[model samples]
Target: MIQIVPIDTPTLGDRSYLVGDGTVAFVVDPQRDIDRVLDLAARHGLRITDVFETHIHNDYVTGGLALARATGAAYHVNAADPVSFDRTPIRDHDVVEVGERMRVRAVATPGHTFTHLSYVLETPDRAPVVFTGGSLLFGSTGRPDLLGPSHTDELVRAQYASAHRLTGGLPDDTEICPTHGFGSFCSATQSEAERSTIGREKQVNPVLTQDEESYVEQLLAGLDAFPAYYAHMGPANTAGPAAVDLAEPRTADPAELRARIDAGEWVVDLRSRTAFAAGHLAGSLNFGLDGSFATYLGWLIPWGTPVSLLGDTPEQVAEAQRELVRIGIDRIESSATGEPEAWSGAAPLGTFPRASFTDLAAVRHHRAVTVLDVRRDSEWAGKHVDGAVHVPLHDLLHRLDEVPRGEVWVHCKSGYRASIGASVLAAAGHRVVVIDDQFDQAENAGLPMTA
Candidate 1:
């Protein structure tokens, strides 16, 4: 019987599955960090026999090539994809034997990408399970616009057809696993579900339920800006990504960090917003390794820019490195770990105060303080302090001067970006206050807000 293990890469909100028959396994849709996949197999006493790629992943680098090479397992990709490297090319209806008794059959399902495919797993006695990588997501389907405007309509039609292809013939009880659209940029809408079946998806998935033309219209209209790094990923995957380097990165003392910072390299602080606000390196930007580190960092940090990491522990640095590398962000120059004061050589460490939104409201004049909302444009348009200066966090570094002079009070939907923004203002030698609270509180408390 096939025992499927879902290895969660929380950083990507993506899952890489291990489908095996107690002896050998096939890892499906793994991220660039292969050690986790390998370690999972080792712990289970199973040898990985193959690594599968459902499509040319755009959000993050694939570990299929690297994992296959490391385990002597064949790497499989769609036969039609224009990959430069050697791989065991697969086609629709092809069945690959994995382990002693488990089998995976490829089903042609194009939508998110031109060559995407979903796989059906059949074990000894259990019902079939379909792994839909970028098509037939839980409540939605993969966005068709990632390939640019030229391909949007064509891919949208293809996506509509692909949705029915699964629901049309598959048994209602067939368990379905989707890799994207669950808080992934590749998805058009976020699927707020962790588990779903073919029957359930047929009832709820937009493409499956709506008229084709209407679905197309809604999808086209809903497309938003995906991560900028997405433009770089397709080319890198097509050219064949190099195996990821998982070795612990080299460390830098404070002097080396200072030189790099002065030389225009990034210094990312991977700590909690609370911890970072207490005190941190003067010029470092706070990304807080706990949140959507890769997505935000990839969005804001320029492509191929060199960076240094400062974290409280080696584990934090290692975790941050893994997330960054998945986006082909391999230019991490150096790292520093432990308490901030342990490392010396920079200007005096700086700090700022975090205030509750209620606290800010209770004490003072809205006109007197400069309240800067650092959320995205969409968020700002939805609701914000009436007199606040709007600067999306991603655009803050470049538009620093646009912020009005005087005490700066920063906020986002939540306190996360507020802390990051506060750090930017603090580093620039401005008096900063992080309005560290929920946006809802500001709105519900009758603070003048305009949507």
Candidate 2:
């Protein structure tokens, strides 16, 4: 029996796969935490003999090198990828055999990156399955602009050709497994479908349906700002990241926590938006554990800043640590888990108010207030509250000077980012109210919206 298991890191919006043929398996695009892959392999009674990288990822630190070292599996990387560590230099059309019936063929499909590859898995009885990684995502293709504008024009054209090449070479029934596009910014556009095949994708995917010119134009038009910390991911992966250290960070006492915050080091509170709004360390920022914590935190913080985590439980701190490492933010200065009072010491906890769009609208009638929209540029461009200053959550910290002086009302598509923005403003001494409601509710609340 053949089993293909997807180990999803929903927090990072990526998936790694473990595929086996009863006795042996191969892993594709594993994350920084390799224990999950080890445990999955053990449960399936499979000895992994090979690990493949479709590309040197730009979004997360890869576990492929560590897993290969631990299991003594052949690490297959593109011969063209300039890396520090030694790997099995695989080229286009190089077929690698697994235990018995399984075989994987590497196809050069450069677009997402110049050295990108897609692996086609073949067996005697079953139809073919292709791991496209960041190349061809469901209903979308990987964004080609990560390398910068100089390479974008060339990469985008190559991306169009690569998509066609895969469809031409593989049968329509071939199953598609990709490493990104489940809320990851790597995808050119988001899709609702959970699973798809070449045939299904051909019918609906913009890359396959539209002409290359049309597809490229639409894709370029839709592209928006990605996380700022993405600047560090490529170099970390190229150097081959060290094995992740998820050990509990040194505990921070109240004095130490206050000291770090006073010194301008990031002391993040990993609680819910509601809890954070009620009370938190005055200077501590809230990148709540409930939302896209790592993405937002990594995006906003100055790179190489000493970060201390404050969470409600040890598990929460550990979870945040795991997510941080995936994005290559490996060093955590310290951590604490308990009530805010314990971490506050003599300092009084700071508080902020959270209201819905209806509340915001009612307040607008009586007084002048600043409305801040912290959604992405694309989202703000699509629709947003009129006269609201737009500073995306990723750019909120650096762009705070642009936010007007008043009782500022903050909101995003949902409440999560609004809370983060509100907290930042609150910490900066701005009287802020978090609009903890959906953006869709704004129209119903009689707020003037730009279409």
Candidate 3:
């Protein structure tokens, strides 16, 4: 009997699977969290024999090579543009044996990227299961526009043919598993249901409903703004990820934390920005403990840096620690164990004042405040508060000098980014106020607008 284990890619909300028969296992599209897969293998007393990358991912880094390196397992990818790091290059019809009862056959599926492929898992008693990387999603399909214009048409045509190959050629009952799910940038249209059957998708998926051209047109129409950081992620994945060292859980006194920070160690405040802005130790960088925390941390902090975590509670600290470990960032020295007591010994960095739209209006009338909008440029263009400076959150770190130090008012669509911006400015000794709400209220009130 074969068992399928689904592991959630916390950052991207994507799913990577581990397939095994209680003796040897195979992992598919292993994300940056290689430890979890290892742990799962250990729990089942199974040895991981293969690590496969269905396609090069853009949203989060892939951990296929890392897992293979750690476990001495073989890493697999398409023969064309074969993954560079000590991997077995697999081509169409290439067979990889897992155990006596299971085998995986590579099937070429190009559309999302120039060299995409899927795996068909053959089991003893059941129909084959297709691991459709980005080719065919639950409700929609992978976008063809990701590949550069030179090969866009060819790739799109290949994608359509690939979809037909799987749906028409494979058994109707073949289980379909995808790399991405709803809310992923990879798939233009994704169903809320993460996994489905080929027959079910053929019957209900709109993209599969139409011919190639119509599908491609619809995909191009609804793409959200891909984050600037995503451009760096894909290439890094192709090259293989650097090893991350996890810090052991140690109870640190406030003096120890301060000494470490004073010694040039990086401190990551893992609480929500709002909580961090409420009151935090001076000089801690704010990246909320929400989605993409590990990804941004990897970018911001150098590998093997002696880092400390500050969370809202003990539970939150543990959660943050586990997330960091998933991405191989294990070098956490210690976490602040208690709240006010934990912070009382440390110097107050500064406070980010909370403001409502009414407060913002009052400040605007005074002419003494500098309003900073930290939402995206497109969001700023949609509408904005009068006399507010446009500085998107991602760029705020680099453009801090552009914001005036006196009486800074930071805001975003809601209060989230504003809170992060406020925390950053406060750490820099700027008097900051984070407007928690009242954007819509202020708009309804017909407050003045500048640009």
Candidate 4:
């Protein structure tokens, strides 16, 4: 029996799959975190046979070449536009046999890119499975407009033809496995579900239903701002990511931690937003352990910047270090040792300006206070505190002039971005406070708020 394993892409709702016949396996569209894939293959007693790239991904870095180098597996991409890497290039109609029962047939599926392909796995007694890559997604199709101005009508038409070729020719029972889930930028209408079938997609996916012209128009219409970092990631993936081989994190004693901090080394607090808000080292930046941990770390901290992580547990510290390495930020010194002892005599702990109903009521009595809500516009519209100014954190850098120069209270759902916002405001010499608690705390406290 063949097995398919999904590797989670943290922060982004993306997934990559490993398919094999127990003894030998192949990986498709691997995310930057390759250890999980390697561990999965070892646990199942399978040797990695090949690494395949469906297309150049724009969100997270691809781990295809990295995995191939580590496992000595042959890397494969379409020969039409061969990936400039050290690998074996396969063409259309090429067959890669995995075992007696399973074989991968590479079918050129373009439109998402000039050189995109989907691999179909054929097995006896079961319908073939199509690793659609970005060409076909559940309830949607990959955007044809990612190529920018080069994505003219001709390219869009080519993409439509590619979608038709796959959906029109594939067996109804063939499973459709995609690299990205819902909320990914690769496809406009990415489904929240990680995986779906060809039959299910044919019924609901609008891009598949439309004629060629309409499909192109619909895809181009929804193209929003692509991340600035995407341009660099494709080339990085095509070449290969640098290997991360740091030793196990050694926790620093208080004296050592202070020395590093005083020497101007960055101290990254890896606890949850709430924990960091409760108490953290003075002047340290708090980046929580939720989604986008690595991406944001790479964005905020320069490459090779010496970083010391402070987390609730040793496991969290290790996870943070691994994530940083995924994006090529690899100058980690060590995690803070004796988390409790390190805090001793560090500085007086300061609370994030959490507003209970009573606190909000007290603030409401003051006529000169301003509540700045740093949440996305969509989130603010869905629900929000009354009379709060909605300025999304990403846009805050440019729109700082819009915020009132008064006693300002910054807030988000919790105090993560709000704390960052508060620090930004404080740096600008504004009187600022961060509320890092649930909104209900204010309501339950009978604090007056407008919708």
By lDDT, the best candidate is 2
lDDT by candidate, in order shown: 0.85, 0.92, 0.76, 0.72
TM-score of each: 0.94, 0.99, 0.79, 0.83
Clashing residue pairs found in predicted model 1: none
Candidate 3: the clashing residue pairs are 244-328, 245-330, 245-331, 246-330, 246-331, 247-330, 247-331, 247-332
- Tens digits of lDDT, candidate 3, 1-72: 899898876466578999999899999998766788899999988899998888887666777888888998
Pitting candidate 1 against candidate 2, the one with the higher TM-score is 2
Best by the TM-score measure: 2
Could you give me the TM-score of model 3 versus the true structure?
Answer: 0.79
For candidate 2, report its TM-score: 0.99
Residue 30, model 1: lDDT of: 87
Candidate 4 local lDDT, 1-451, one digit each (tens): 8998877664665778888787889999886668889999999998998888888776667778778989999989776653566678887789998767778899888877888888998988688899887788888777766667766566667767877788788888889888765566677665666567778877777767777677777777666544444556667766667566656777676667667767767777777666655666665666777746665555444345588888878778878877766555555787763453365355655445555435666778767578888766655766676777777766665678888997888887666677666655654556666776665576676655555
Model 1, runs deviating above 4 Å: 344-346, 362-367
TM-score of 1: 0.94
Between candidates 2 and 4, name the one with more favorable lDDT. Answer: 2
User: Candidates ranked by lDDT, best first?
Assistant: 2, 1, 3, 4
- Residue-pair clashes per candidate: 0, 0, 8, 4
